[model samples]
Target chain A: MADKIFRVNMADLTTSIEDIPADWAGHGGRGLTSTIVSAEVEPTCHPLGQNNKLVFAPGLLSGTAAANSGRLSIGAKSPLTGTIKESNSGGTAAQLFAKAGCKALIVEGLPKADNWYSLALTPDGVTITEEKELIGQGNFAVVQALENRIEGKHGLLSIGQAGEMRLASANISIKDPDGSLRSCGRGGLGAVMGAKKIKFITVDPKDGKVAIAKPDAFKDANRIFAKALVDHPVSQALGQYGTNVLTNIINESGGFPTQNFTKGQFEGHESISGETMHDTIKERGGKVKHGCHQGCVIQCSQIYNDADGKKLTAGFEYESIWAMGADCCVDNLDHIAEADRIMDDIGIDTIETSVAMGVAMEAGVLPFGDGAGICKLLTEDITKGTGIGRIIGNGAGSVGRAFGITRVPVVKNQAIPAYDPRAIKGIGITYATSTQGADHTMGYTIATNILNVGGKVDPLTKEGQVELSRNLQIATAAIDSTGMCLFIAFAALDDEKCLPALVDLLNARFDLSLTGDDVVSLGQHILKTERAFNTAAGFTSADDRLPEFFYNEPLPPHNVVFDFSGEEIDTFWDF
Target chain B: MKISVKLFAYFRDNRFKIKEYDIDEGTTVGNIVDDLNIDREEVGVLMINSRHTNFDVHPVEKDILAIFPVIGGG
Candidate 1:
């Protein structure tokens, strides 16, 4: 078995070699990262300090042409949320890492100085090179520099000035096939990389092709999985409209956080919804349905263009649209597209940055719907480190604090994602209780068959949300470890056969026997571990809650307030 | 009888861009959706006169209808 571990210590510039435990071979990717992070990192320590380690791993099915399986996860204690965080991204890195014959790469400790550097990995070993010249460069430029140095095709993960400044909203940008930037953009993990003084990582495929443990079984399983993804209605919608498909649904549900959550529905939501984006791209002849990673059957990304048909940004997904469009009250798609480009280039978490801008607007820094002004602030002042831009880059909670805004929507310092908890009660429960604050992916409720694990209740009822959230969190934890994209859960929920097929694939790949029940157990274990860590870190049950405004001011359209009491919310994890 | 209908997301691009439809009086949101040649399964939630409505809810003149997709987590 080709099992190896690569460890880099920034404090002393030391590299060590280790062997992976035999049990870990089956885990791979996200599973490995979660395990390692939980075992090694101290939960309550300063996230940017030497106590936290950043772990990168590819999925169990990655590197073998498993459609949509080329995902890499970065796990760390979040500087922004003060909780466990794992952000997954699609690019060439995971495939390259798998090909290099290493299951995981762990970067531990912190550099002693403010110097900038990049890590270059080859078949031989890892090399740290001075990249001071590339300091302060945006994500696009940083990727270009690394690409030129590596020769031919190379996978990269780099940060922009926002990370360099240790901004909580920073993101780690991964180079896409077209030289555009995609990111593992949440939980402020980029700041952790920045704290390590590492500017970028270049993974060259010169390491060779990845070898699958069971090629025949992998191929069979992947074929079935790929077909399922292609046939699913959710996949079809995503392929057609990209992520902006949620705009109308969220608005209709009265959960599209508008004007800084002062309102729920955006009046001009249709103009910026996924359908509008698709039409605009078609009329301009721009490319739609771009893939984030190789061999992805459901290409739910897009290359948005301006009126002149010039490319503005790639993969302007739903979270970015809600944060910039509905949250900020901007209806114009072009403006939202431009803002997306700015966030990508600047290496900022689009969700956090957009929410920060909304909060800033609420503070009267700029009027809501001032899309042009927001763009200028991000592109010009933020890069230049101006006064307002500095606070905006700091993230939503910080910006809210700096401006004395009380209505900021956040939990544990992390700005909430696109979903409004009041309308989608189950999702709100997830957001409130997730180890990572206000994160949607921690327990996605929208498009999953959650087994009715929590007794069935009306979608509009608050009765079973806490239980549903708990079940989803456990299931999500298990899925994350396999390095499978959480999107797969959509099929897994609806297709009773899908989970068993996935288990079979895992068993064949690792040459071990496992069942669907084992997957559930594994997921539960991960959630329990994360919860223990958070508890040890001093987070109490009270910390898991929505903002008071959610309780007092009912959201529009539905007019449903966040009604779950703290005691009821705490009952979620009783199982 | 005329009803103001706004198609959001993919529905707008696919079938509702060119012109607004005026259906017979007492027509339901379901009927208008059927008349527009839009697949009912693809539409997730239906709103009539700014209130949440089931697919079976009938429509009236001057009533505004909004339809959206079911799959929405990002």
Candidate 2:
């Protein structure tokens, strides 16, 4: 069966299934979602309004026995950044979504009533149910209730009170195979979902019965791909240490973005470093090197445990550690872990909220390095929707505006992640020009600039940074559309055979003739569609810029500022 | 002369996270890494007193030198 698009319009509670448009057959994941949003939705409409749409799409190779190819991309006109957002994640939902033969699932329009609803997808069709019983619960409870409540073996995607309240930093939580939650956690698409009154989404596992076009060819390509992934030293290290391995290294490199971007290094960074976190996790009998989703070879995710050896969090990332630990000046690893768990349960983007905490700290709403106080702010104040909580929940930009804080590290109203752009010039271009706001995943130049995964580019120099960022952004857009985990890039960049193998996998899956150049075209096409949409939404080249403070404030360690001019950053769009 | 040396990420797996190293005042970062037995090819980034430095950079007295292996997540 040809994959079909399932459209749900909340205005009158209607649904329609349509065949995949010929033009859209080649696109999936970010490419598909961005294409649909750019073509179907009004770009200038308010993000949470009826005219805006939220789209979920599995990658082209999803659910087809492709290793590490279970990524799901969620696209929308972002409530947080007010730009085009394509936030992707690894979880069971993408596999199931594709297995059910869905090219894309689009949620459009606003519900007429104030009540909430839920949708369950079976191989046969989609069923919408009015569910008020589980409205205010967190993601953990939502996933738990659905098993007994809905009677199905399926993957779950849900939101928490943060989403229900339409917080700008809200994210949609997806249940992993182990019943732990992962997130499509950027750009506030959760707010759009909430505005449409979707409490949760479940796709039944039996619905997935996908067949690869050329089984033997796919098998051979996948074998080569998996070998490349596991053989790479970086992939092996990630499988062992998880992403938190970056904490100490980034901090030591003098680009950790500490204390709301006041400095690049944190005095208390060592306390929350990956080494310390790993030691504590080991002592607590926690499992490291776990995968957030099934079929992932490089398992950078871990199941962090508390003192009692109980589950604390999964997928505890380096950026979150930086945002909650160093950026906010709270270094107690346990406190940071608890905060990470809470952020997950509450369905907020960890990076945005952590940066919001930094903004709040700068406002004197909460003091920096106050571990207990930060927890209280999240649990007591933010959860209950107090005035301060609401402001912070609105995201870093709102918090900075409310408090008159000028040093906020945000571009296009979305907070930057762990890396200090002033210290690493290449990422500055990415943060400045990314259509999704200050998003690192949009163009992870760190691979080349810092990690030397692709090629070495001087982190402190302006030369090659723009070119590096542009190439990475294009490559990333293509990767996000492929349904494979981004970590594959570590292998693909280093081993020349890795990318061709991935292309072969896709070609085998679809029975087509695709080359490395075709992959590049796919990437370039997605970026162009997204940029055109952003431009239609009133994003001038002027909007593609870092914050003024990034230019004025010199981060210590390097004492360097984001020195790229508007003309230089604008060159990213020349593609 | 003594310079404060820090090891980051896997560089500290079996080694020290940080320590006071007794090196000559003009000792280069490459010399210190060699003394610590960290592979030169394995080092991704290097810094001195919070500023980015290369292996050829010789630390002054009281300098805080840090060595990091390749690491990227975000």
Give the candidate number with the greatest TM-score.
2
Residue-by-residue lDDT tens digits, candidate 1, A373-436: 8899998878777888878988899888898888889988889988788777888888888877
In model 2 chain A, the worst 10-residue window by lDDT is A204-213
Every model's Cα RMSD, please? 2.8, 1.9
Candidate lDDT scores, in order, read 0.80, 0.87
| Residue A448, model 1, lDDT | 31
Candidate 2 stretches greater than 4 Å from native: B1-4, B23-43, B46-65
Per-residue lDDT tens digits for candidate 2, residues A1-575, read 56889888888888888888899999999999999999888988999898999999999989888889999999999999888889999889899998888889988888898878998776666777798889989999998888787776688899998999899999999999888889999889888888989999999847457778999999999999999988887876786668877877677668888888898888887788777777777889998778877789888888889999998988898888889999999978889989999988889999999899998899898799998887888898778888988898889999999999998888999999989998889999999888889988888988877776798887888999999999999999999999999999988888988999999999999999999999998898888999899999898999988889889989887788888889988888787
- Docking quality tier of model 1: acceptable
